[model samples]
Target: MTKPSSTDRPNPLQVACSSCNLRELCLPVGFSGSELERLDGMVATRRSVKRGDALFRSGDAFEAVYAVRTGFFKTQVSSEDGRDQVTGFQMAGELLGLDGIVSDHHTCDAVALEDSQVCVIPYAELEALSREFGELQRQFHKIMSREIVRDQGVMLLLGSMRAEERLAAFLLNLTQRLQARGFSPTSLVLRMTREEIGTYLGLKLETVSRCFSRFQEDGVLEVKLKHIRILDLAALRKMVNSPC
Candidate 1:
């Protein structure tokens, strides 16, 4: 990907973590002004990715971890049979590129599900800053732990959950994350397509569509193409928590 032009960069003061609205979600809590400035300095640039483009691909050198300043992304890895398997979806205020920390190269492709911008935090500089700030180090560790936990949850979804249950859990997770970012808990426009959701949830495209229809028939959701409104949140939660 080409570097963003100098003119496209946001003013440092504007993008500084100290004043960023996402600071509470993206940064460790209770950092002093000085610490926030230092952390902000680690993010020296912002990159814009257009819809349908990849921010990073498998085998690319990992130089930094990106913070999604806006929009959404999906990370996927190719299977042995050459099919792309969607691993996870990431949204604004979330971090990406952690997959490369152990190997120094990205193992999956991070593609924009919509037009997106990310704060580029150079990993080396971030490491230095984290060393000086104990809270930053702890927060970084917590982020990694969360990724692990999410992966385990995906495993459970694929291994045992029925198609309806898998889709219900996926919607619940997506809505919860969006709600954390101040979005309505019941309404959303899905950034990824039904096919992509099927790929992520390990369901066939037709099966995914059928499950949506079933949910609508059962008064659980109001579906209008990409727009989804949960008409019965309690029913979805019940489906997810139902005995296997």
Candidate 2:
């Protein structure tokens, strides 16, 4: 795991959650004016992480949760045999470090896929604020619930889906997330390498490459290195929904 350098430290500049454009998509969603002010006060700093640097690694003390302001990140864990398994990918407007809430220590490493910015919300202050504000507590609970559901979805994908189905599902999910962030739904530049994708999907690197090649041959996608364009969105969806 890459150690965080001095440059990765949180900047002292105050983050204004109320005025941040990502408010609707982040923790401040649906907050009243006064509530937003409280949140803005709680989120005191913004941190920048350069590509390939870890924001936090396994067993690190967890002081706060970070809300992604820009760029992407992947959460991974090292296996006993020294293999790293990609657990999940996070993008703008998503929260990281939630995995630490239970034990007060991170269980996985969060590495930036590109230069990224994040708003730091101190967990202690956030907890206090949530206790005082019912709406905030509800929103926080909802976010946690969403994470649980996502984990379950990943389990289903890995446990039952075929190689082609897993790849198609991954692309569809990635495009949908990008579309939610106002990017084109059918086209994307992959931030993680194919090997990383295979790690997350529980497939071999060679299998991942062959799956992409097959998709290209079937006119389901146009792939150029890291860039991918979905030529047959319906076909891809059918692959995911097709019988096991």
Candidate 3:
């Protein structure tokens, strides 16, 4: 048998929904082979965005949703005070542009945190396909439902959790999401800056730093700038679950 070379490996960009590694985490779930081919047709094209570039700015018309094929992104909303708040972070296999659907225009800015590639699922085509496929319709609704649930959890974190609890919960959530995407659950390279994280967690930058230092002193984790190595996942969990 001829030996397979690097060229033989599947190219992520060329792979269709039926063969994509992220199929389990994307829209391909619950779709049959024939359905997957049809689903692929809805993805009009692939787009590349450079770091620090806006995928879609607030007030831009919403035409499609994007599936992250590579790299990370952050969504933000600007306040009347001229301050910007980090709303969420997105990684490979996750969907973006949903915030635009309700109003027919993007409500926040989706910016690339790294050089990224996304599969563009044109909204009209996707809606038409969903109408023809009952399973697809249900799956799309389920995805939107999870997004709503995630937002509720964020509200709970901000309203009730203490600084440590909020930070811990944030780490735990990030770790779990990374794990789901086949990355290490206990280690991560933070894509957003500390200030952005503080904004999201409702803490000051110094407060976020203090929490990280305190966690390290307690042997819970090791932090070196953007890189983090979680040493005591159970301890972090306990901190998040403990009463304020």
Candidate 4:
């Protein structure tokens, strides 16, 4: 078997270094050299998360917004039955917990689905930085816009898409997402559990299992336990883009 190629991620930012992928979206892209330096100094710390680890639980006190340095995570809210209802998934270079800043507390739990790193930037400090850096405010707005767009996409996907269509589209979305973060999209290990997936998709566990088997039997995808190989992306796209 061929081993995956390793990528040399540049040395992490001491304070918003050019090496950071999120600098473009998380910080002012057009900051004057001096302004950028000052803004960087306010950033305090970063934390690493392993698969199945919770970055913050629902109702945790909000301190700073977390920017993904690597890997993927999911956000979930507890349902009345004591089970979690998955609400969001984030990838490398994305921001998590931005919404919590407004309320001063977390509304959902943020859990890592794979080994991940996060850079925490204090909201109170950012308010001060935004005054000195006009572009920093713009970057904040850009991130907000992306959040709105993603939420809308999920609503549309869940309400209108068929079960099989939803499953394939979800895989395709995950594949393209991982690819953007420098991972192989075609054959990769599943990070999130099947139960998490079903909760996110609004499907029963048995239904999700059956959909996987049907996709495999029909040669659209190959599934062996948790590892998946997408054999027919074109067909999957057709399903996702199909008119319901």
Candidates sorted on lDDT, descending: 2, 1, 3, 4
In TM-score terms, candidate 4 sits at 0.84
lDDT of 3 by residue, 1-244 (tens): 4755321233346647776778888877867788888877777577778898888999999999998988899988998898887888888888999999999999999999998878888899889989988998998898899889999999999999999999999999999999998789999999988888998888999999999999999999999999999999999999989854
Can you write out model 2's per-residue Cα lDDT over 1-244, one digit (the tens) per residue?
Answer: 5876644576655469888888888987888898888888888888888899888999999999999998899999998899988999999999999999989999999999999998888999989999999989999999999999999999999999999999999999999999988899999999998899999999998999999999999999999999999999999999999944
Q: Estimated TM-score per prediction?
A: 0.94, 0.94, 0.92, 0.84
- Candidate 2 lDDT score relative to the true structure: 0.92
Angstrom error at residue 104, model 3: 1.2
Show the colliding residue pairs in model 3: none
Model 4 weakest 10-residue run by lDDT? 3-12
| Tens-place lDDT digits, model 4, residues 1-244 | 2643222223354646344556654544565667667766766567778788888888899988888877789999997689778888887667898768778999899999888878777888877877766778777887788789988888887898878887887898888877866678787777777778889988877888999999899898899978999898887788788743
Regions of candidate 4 where Cα sits further than 4 Å from its true position: 1-16, 21-36
Better model by TM-score: candidate 1 vs candidate 3: 1
In order, the Cα lDDT scores of the candidates are 0.90, 0.92, 0.87, 0.78
Report RMSD for candidate 2: 2.5
